[model samples]
Target: MKKENSMKRALVSVSDKTNLVPFVKGLEEHGYEIVSTGGTKKALDEAGIKTISIEDVTHFPEILDGRVKTLNPYVHGGLLARRDLPEHMKTLEDLSITPIDLVCVNLYPFKETILKSGVELADAIENIDIGGPSMVRSAAKNYQSVTIVTDINDYDQVLTEIEENGDTTAETKAKLGAKAFRTTAAYDALISQYLTAQVGLEDPEKLTLTYDLKETMRYGENSHQRAWLYEDALPKSFSILEAEQLHGKKLSYNNIKDADEALRCVREFDEPTVVAMKHMNPCGIGRGDSLEVAWDRAYEADSVSIFGGVIALNRKVDLATAEKMRKIFLEIIVAPGFDDDAFAVLAKKKNIRLLQVDFDQKDEPTKDEVVSVMGGLLMQDQDTLKEDCHDWEVVTDVKPTEDQLKAMMFAWKAVKHAKSNAIVVANNERTLGVGEGQPNRIDSLKIAVKHAGDLVEGSVLASDAFFPFDDCVKYAGEHGVKAIVQPGGSVRDQDSIDMANKLGIAMVTTGVRHFRH
Candidate 1:
């Protein structure tokens, strides 16, 4: 590398000109020459900033509808040449090309184009830029002599450091270069995933993932460990992982985990529902005619556990609900939206995080889910919502009433939130008890009955998996469970149905099992 730092020359081409004017001005103020292409050049010129066209630098004109502009040898040679290598210098001299010290290039908005409903294939294909990734990779490969900037948010910081130090340090260049490669890699991964899905491909070997780090948490599960949050390709999906914090301290690892579980539980209900979660377990859950009533019922479900728990609501939070929530020491609260009055009421508790996520509209099932282990990953299909209730089979002499069937469905939804070997008992629209992560079905039923206490009378039960024996059904009858819903596939299904009939309890099979394990 050159021992002495020199005046920087930047190649700036971007489809998103969010901070282009100020960025180019900063480069000009720092004595850096700007070389841009096509619309980017026009944008800078219109913004009253001096710029050199890429055609002028390469001594060739842009052709093929702007696709052939920055792929020239001059551009790549300038970005890739090593200052310390004599052959590299000789090659550059032979080509009469000057080294590009910095590259601030972002690709065309392919993801944005694809996100638009009814977007044609031609439109999406045309948005994919060829030159942007090439220039980024070249600059990143030669990080010792080049600084690459792919994100507009980094523009001002990079400009400030260069202005103060004359040139970017090796550390800054290396960091920026790493980010640049990751940016292009993620972009390619997204394209591959989209195209593969578009063609109706079922090959699991073709699946790909692209994620970007949103923020680093204080710790993993505890304060002594480190953690970070990342999002997959889609940014429009308003997940707890994708939420932007409008106020309060950064989210801790436990806070995010609890908030995610709370969000998932609340999203399961179509009607207005409120769920309170602690340590990835639902402490309380309720649905009401109105959100305020639901919030109150959820709070009353288990008052002690609701303390410092994460609360999530399915509807827009009103002032009454916010006021009631403010009374407790909550870690976080999330809803689809908040009205002005509700926002004002909740804002008083500044320490709590309030997030708005449109769960009803954006609950698309993810294609792949990966869980990490000590040395590898376990991949599986995402747990998707089953919409067909009519397909469920009534397997008992005593069929459930319409109201009881609704409660059974609700209990089934609640069971999905519980851990494996889960059992949930509910009456009306409120969760009476949840038994989670038990070793067996009968044990789970016993736990649910024990937790439910007096509320188990006339309540409906939901099991995550099939009842292997009639012991669970007999146990439910003793707990006053009037109805039961489970996936029926075990060989002793007839015995279980016979037990339900003898006990005068209604039983149904969903055909589909929800095994969390």
Candidate 2:
């Protein structure tokens, strides 16, 4: 075995030869022997740097399409043998093998190949590195003595430490070892994920998901719970998670959850829209020609419920809208962008969190919604269904007018965003009142009607689900609700139809229920 005091040997093999030429030169300056594979040795020689090939170290030529080079026992023994243990040192000493102090390597371009369009299976298979990961793992396992460097970004740090202090620190070795293991794990995960996608596995019995930690929170919903924010390994599109905080305190767990709901609701409208949320339920929603008008009407929809709520807008926030939003003590405000003056004004308040997300980067609505349970996860298709007036059947003898149908359609969009057992009273493309998360449909109706006050006379009512009995229709009639829209699949549908006709109310069945729970 080679003496540690005199000189050390380093094995350098990398598919990503980012800084290898200069790095290998540095090793030679410090009296270290560099051993590398075919291309690395050739490149080092071409660069006027001395490097011994693996064939010279193992006394065997690289064969079997170059797969048989570093898998030999001479290389493995040099890497795996412990210098501190007498038996391990004797094994290497008897075999005339030297101990490897450093292993600098990165995996094959498997990830790059998979990213290319129309890449062949044989190409992907050939790019999978066998000896590289094996050597990296071997060196990382002996981190007490062997330093494993996987990333090119770490090259300068390693070189600086070696130039200053003859050897790399044990702490750096441990950190680099951890990064090596993680890199291999991520590599295998990508391969598995890509193959699983190709085979069209809708729902595999075993599900594996990868996420990278983005932030560590002080606490969760309650201070007793610890929390962290992890982004998806491969994000599908823009989301609140990627939002840039322009001003105010960092978002809390509850704040992010409610903000997500608000943003998703506002994305449903193509016009200038505003949605205010509390506890993940939208309290106020409005659409108008301008964002200022939308913000005004949405806040007025339920002024009491919007306090300390999260706000989301689909359009750029102008100065007029920003000033109006600052009137209330809000937890968050999210939009695509803000006017310079508006942003300056909003920045005055330090506690309210402000975020900007791009409107063009919105995701497709039909993706899966995943819910985590005690021991597993549940996934289902997202509710992207839209109600068409042409598909609706007007059950009452008095049919809804064109304007009334338009109002009902607007109300349907809002009702879909509300929780189950919802009732929304909207007119002129704005919600006047909303009742959601109630135990019974009657209570929801009463709450919605009561909130509307006298405005319920000409407003159209929308229910997320069908009316089980005629009582809701009777109450809507008594309250002077002119039009009612609901999904008509109940066994007693005729009862509500009869009540609607008798009360001279126009009722329509959309055939599509918007139950959001």
**Model number with the top TM-score:** 1
Give the worst 10-residue stretch by lDDT in candidate 2.
1-10
| Candidate 1 local distance difference test against the native | 0.85
285-393 in candidate 2: lDDT tens per residue? Answer: 8888999999988988889999999999998889999999988899999999999999988989989998998778775433467788999778887777655776799
Weakest ten-residue segment in model 1 by summed lDDT: 1-10
Each candidate's root-mean-square deviation in Å? 3.1, 4.1
Task: Estimate, for each residue in 13-32, the C-alpha lDDT of model 1 and write its tens digit.
Answer: 99899988898898887778
lDDT of each: 0.85, 0.87
Q: Stretches of candidate 2 above 4 Å error?
A: 1-9, 13-33, 36-50, 54-101, 106-131, 137-179, 363-367
Error of 1 at 186 (Å): 1.5
Alpha-carbon shift of residue 416 in model 1 (angstroms): 1.3
TM, every model: 0.89, 0.83
